[model samples]
Target: MFSDSEIPFDVIQAYLETHYHVHGRAPTTLQVGEANALLAALHETAGVACSAFLTACNPFSQQLEPPRNLELQEALAESLQQRGLRFIGGIGQHPANGWPGEESFLVLGLALDDAKALGTQLGQNAIVWSGADATPKLLLLR
Candidate 1:
C-alpha cells in the first residue's frame, strides 16, 4: 500500500500490520487507521490534540544489535526530556511475530512537522502519528 517509500513493500506492510503499544498507567495498543478511544481520552486528559510514535532503532530499516538499539532509544528519550516533551515508552511489533519489536515513544503534543523532522533526524523512514482523531497514520519521511 505504501508504494512510494524506498523502504521495501514487505517492510511497509509490517509497519501497517504492527501493533504500537503505549505503556502507562492504562496501557494502550494502537493500530494504523483504527480509532482508539483510550488514546482519544488520553489526548483530552493531556490537553493535547496530537501525538507521535517514534523510535530510533533500526534506522533506515537497517537492523542493529539489541544493545545498540536500546542505547539509541535511551538517547531518544533523553532528547525528548530535554525538549520538555511528555512521552510514554512504547513498542511496535507485528502480532504474527518474526520481526523484533522496536522500542518507541508516544510523544504527546508533538506537531506533524516536528515529528517528520525528528524521524528524519533519527534516520528513520517513517513514523506513526495521530491527531485529535486518534487514528494512527504511517507517515513516510524518506
Candidate 2:
C-alpha cells in the first residue's frame, strides 16, 4: 500500500481534499485532513500488499477513485486521450491528472517523488504548477 509520504505532499493533499467522502462532487479543500485519513484507510483495506500503483483506491469505493476524479474526470480524459493514456473503461480512473490547469500535483503515471522532480528537471511549463500553493498535508482514515 502507498503511504502519504509515497506521493508528493501537494497532490496527496489534493487527492485527499477532493476525493474524500465525495458524492459525485469534488471535496472542498478544507477537508484535506479527512481525505488523508480516507486514503490511509483504503490502503489498509486493500491489504497494503504493495501492488502496482497502490490501486489508488478501490474503484468500488468512493475514497480512492483515481487521479482524474469526477471533479476533473473530463479534463483528465482529454489529457489521457491527448497523451495516449487511452480510454480503458472499467479500469477505474487513471492514476493521475497531467493537465496544465488541473495539475494538482506531479504528472500522472510517475511516482510522487518523480513527479515532483519533473518541474525542476524540465521547466515551469513542463510540470504541474498550482498558481496558488496552499497548505501541505497528509491524512489517514478518520
Candidate 3:
C-alpha cells in the first residue's frame, strides 16, 4: 500500500491519459479540474500529505452554463457531505502554471474507496497510480 504522497504527478498524468484513451474521449477541463480537486480532498480527508495539483477557474465557464454549473457543484458538495467528506472551495492563481486568472473550484476530501464510489456514481473513472512499484488501478464508473 502506498501513501498519497508516494503518488507521482507523472503517474497521475499517465492514468489521466489512459482514461482518455480507454474512454475514447478526453476529460473536459472541468473534469480534469474536478479530478485533481477530488484527489486533494481525498488526501486531506485521510490526513495524508496531498500531492495533488489544484487550480482555480471561473465557476461559470463557457463549457457549462450558470444554473447547470451551480447545480453540479451543489450536487458534488452534497454527495461528498453525505459521504462524510469535507468540501474545500477556493479562488487563486493556477497552482500548476501560476497563470494570472482567478477561478473557483470545489474539492472533497475522500478515501480511495470513497473516491471510487463517488466516481462510479458520477459515471467517471477513478484512475490512480499508487506508486512506482505497483500497477495502476482503474476504477470504471458507468
| Every candidate's lDDT | 0.93, 0.30, 0.36
Which lDDT tens digits does candidate 1 get at residues 24-107? Answer: 987999999999999999889999999999999999989999999999999999999999999989999899958899999999
lDDT of 2 by residue, 8-110 (tens): 4554444443421211222322232222342233334433311111122222123433453544545544554576431222221223453122223222233
Q: Can you tell me which runs of candidate 3 are displaced by over 4 Å?
A: 1-46, 49-64, 90-109, 125-142
Give candidate 2's whole-model lDDT.
0.30
For residues 22-98, what per-residue lDDT tens digits would candidate 3 score against the true structure? 11122112223234443433444546542211221222112444455457656765655676644445333323543
Q: Lowest-scoring 10 consecutive residues by lDDT in candidate 1?
A: 1-10
Q: How far does residue 52 in candidate 3 sit from its true spot (Å)?
A: 8.2
Which rank order by TM-score, best down to worst?
1, 3, 2
| TM-scores of all candidate predictions against the true structure | 0.97, 0.23, 0.37
Tell me the deviation in Å of residue 116 in model 1.
0.5
Preferred candidate (TM-score higher): 1 or 3: 1
- The top-ranked prediction according to lDDT is 1
Give the distance in Å from residue 72's predicted Cα in candidate 3 to where it truly belongs: 1.5
Task: Work out how many backbone clashes candidate 2 has.
Answer: 6
